[model samples]
Target: MLIQKVRFERSPKLHAMMTEAPYPVNARVVVQGKRGPEVATVRDEAEPMPGDGRYGMILGAASEADLDRWAELGREAEDLKWLLRARARARGLPVKIVAAEFTLDGSLLTVSYSAEERIELGALIQDLRGHTRARINFAAVGPREQAMMLGTLGACGRENCSSHHLQDFAPVSIRMARDQQLPLNPEKLSGPCGRLLCCLQFEHTQYLDLLKDVPRKNARVCHDSSGACGKVVKLHPLEGTVDVLTDAGMMQGVPASELRVLKGEPAPGQQKNRPRD
Candidate 1:
């Protein structure tokens, strides 16, 4: 598969694997760095990097040794975390060191953290470089990336999607919101990344399937009276009910059996509910 390096230019340098050869969902990558490397597998395929293409590097088909290096570095992730934290405090940088992971090849050491502003972390980088003898990178991860680094069980009682199965992060739109009829609350809609949840894409096909057979909301239908027409009110896909507004001057609740959909006309042929002349 086409592998990618997960380096946070504005954050840290963590190498990850793009699982698929050409890169598809949950594309796994082994992040390589000094102090050890990590395998930050992609839960989605790597897309073309936007803009100047300065996001991260890519490595093709790593070896077994590469994976071992990641495991070794993971062992000291906690210790390096402590060092970075102490260093940040002494340097008077208001930062929260979330987590740290080493690269698989020992070529780089990435420190993951979060902060309010872009704190000058040059000193911290220098310190880590000198101490670890590897390329030092300070990664400022957000809620989403943080969730990827420090994984935990999900609401479904399984590992978080980013940490386990999702390869690349896709753009979650308000369409998913409208489709689910969910409240337009950012907090409620967002996942660990502080963006729309990945699960929103799940079962989307099924929803589309249900909608396929249903008539359009604006569709017009005919009432029992051959001369009367009606406007579609609401649709019940599963129940096959098409509640309609009768064009007749008067209307009464009627079962769908008493109604026939109007065809071949923009407006209703018969007016069931209308004003008296």
Candidate 2:
């Protein structure tokens, strides 16, 4: 048995496998998957001598003839996509087909889609089988996975994280944005996946840690040199500054290092925007 990592569109990363032998990168191989004999491209080397009684064996490496057939199927897949969409509309299936993948031998084709909930596509499956004469499998994906599978560009005008380098999705929430003092606008905070931007979670811990040094808005503070009591109207966490509203109604933006606060308040670990007075 040879060890290999194979790529399947349904999976986020390469699926682990113990196949017949090592296949060169880009070489297509047949492997038994949960659905049936599936086609996958050899992506990278894997651990040798892995005990894979649970993993499916690589049916075989593709021959030149099989490669020719694989190319033919690629052309046919496009037509199949249009046919599948038309059939879905006819049957009134509430799903949006995202992508399709076929095995190297063209014996099976997996159709991936996005839907609000589980959908029964038995009739649509039968129609697809009749048109392609191949075993049909259905995979449901979320908005993020749909963007990843289709390699969609995000609101940033760049390829989305899932499609580029992000291998997995981490839960993102509006809290992260608030913690970072970001504006709460949905358009600014959401990505192409219709979810919070993944970048919000990247430095959250650091932001929190930095925030420990900054005095919070609306807290009472004192100036080091002037000894004037003021209410913290804003903080600039990154710049290490605070905007203060003095008892005399004067506004002063001073470095965090120069600001002092009550005993129980946070140390100026970082700066933040001032809160509205």
Candidate 3:
């Protein structure tokens, strides 16, 4: 029989699952992991996954005995997190324990936490070893990762996108905001992660394309029918309107289609850091 590949349903950072076989969704099964067999649900239909000898397999749907054992492990892991958190707090460690998970066989407890910066944990790990016979694994994550592991609400008045569905973060910069004519205020543009908002990347491409047909701010323009000239003061892209400072000393908003560029060289106040269209 041909062996097929499958991935267990769960966040890769929080729970590791991969390997071979075809299985139906919601089928509880145990796969031989590095430490021991662990319980995981058949997340979805199986698909092929290329591997270099680091894959685990689905032994089969979990038995009643296996389910009982998994429940016991969950309670134990919760207790472990509490203990570790108390100890770290007592030592004045700058860390927030997000979660703790036990290896299927109970040989190890993987503790996840977030820290502002790196700090020595050698002494703490050693102390944990002496306290618990089982080995402990420490995983450090950033603020966004912490929220994803734990969960958080965003300024958008909803559950954070990262925690709920944003699996991968893309690079965002001030340029994205500039391209969209958004206020460059950091507080308004940043997300709960203290980084640029993830949504900034969404409409950037549309803004870039819209800018091609728009004239830059302070560019000289004239009404084709009346031959009255003016310098562009502002542009409302979605409205298809342009505010112009007419040579007659009046500022008026007019349809973009009625205006033609008076100069072909360049517009004043056009900079990579400041583009108004």
Candidate 4:
């Protein structure tokens, strides 16, 4: 048995499954998904692992009729989305319907939604079940997942990373923005998902590597090139430069290589006797 990575049309993550024979990349195949047999596109070949049975099996390549049925199911799912929204509105529910998907056999209907807080969906599910013969399942998603489902554009005018090629969301923190010397404003720092921008982590490690040897802002230092002692006012990590305010009150952009930390005096905000990294 061989293993391959496949991706469902409505999902962002790739799934590993066991296939009896090799399949070319991007080939449409029917696989045993959580909802039952469903159409998925082959992403790539995956290395076989021990106990691959838990990953499920690829039933076979999708037939022409299977492809047609998949398309038809997509249209039906779209129609179902509007019905779900209307039903939720009638019940005064706070959920926003993001997407709807159906299994290949139409045995299961999965609905993805976003909400400000946890919502009791027992009544809503009951009402939906009454209207459709297929079993209904509701999935609650966070802001980032909602953005991924909607396929929104980011500030850079490109498709969102979460919606594009990012297989998983990495942990992003406000400390990343602060380390990069970015403005703390929420609007500028946030992506379309209203969370910290995912790109903040892209160059973060590079910035950390550059700043490791450089003195912190407002730290007392002496410039070797001009032999002038001054305080570091700003850092240009990418350029390997620092702006120093000299004792004569003149500002000069000095290379980080030429500046050495002055002894005993700490950076303005730093505590005494504590060594700065």
**Candidate achieving the largest TM-score:** 4
What's the TM-score of every candidate structure? 0.55, 0.79, 0.76, 0.91
Question: Tens digit of lDDT per residue, candidate 2, span 117-157?
Answer: 77888887888867787778888888888878878777778
- Pairs with steric clashes in candidate 4: none
Candidate 3 per-residue lDDT over residues 80-182, each given as its tens digit: 7888788889889988888887766778877788887787777678767765677888888777676666666778788777776665777888888877777
Superposed model 2: Cα runs more than 4 Å off: 1-12, 18-66, 264-277
What TM-score does structure 2 among the candidates reach?
0.79
Candidate 4 Cα misplacement greater than 4 A, ranges? 50-53, 265-277
Models, CA RMSD each: 9.1, 4.1, 4.3, 3.3
Model 1 scores a C-alpha lDDT of 0.58
Per-candidate count of clashing residue pairs (backbone under 3 Å) = 50, 18, 1, 0
lDDT per model vs. reference: 0.58, 0.77, 0.71, 0.83
lDDT of 3: 0.71
Candidate 4's residue-wise lDDT over 178-255, tens digit each? 778787899999999889999999998887777775678778999877789888888787788889999999999998
- Which stretches in model 3 have alpha-carbon errors above 4 Å? 1-21, 26-44, 48-56, 63-68, 225-228, 248-251, 255-258, 265-277
Give the candidates in order of TM-score, highest first: 4, 2, 3, 1
Worst 10 residues of 3 by lDDT: 1-10
Worst 10 residues of 1 by lDDT: 268-277
Clashes by residue pair, model 3: 28-62
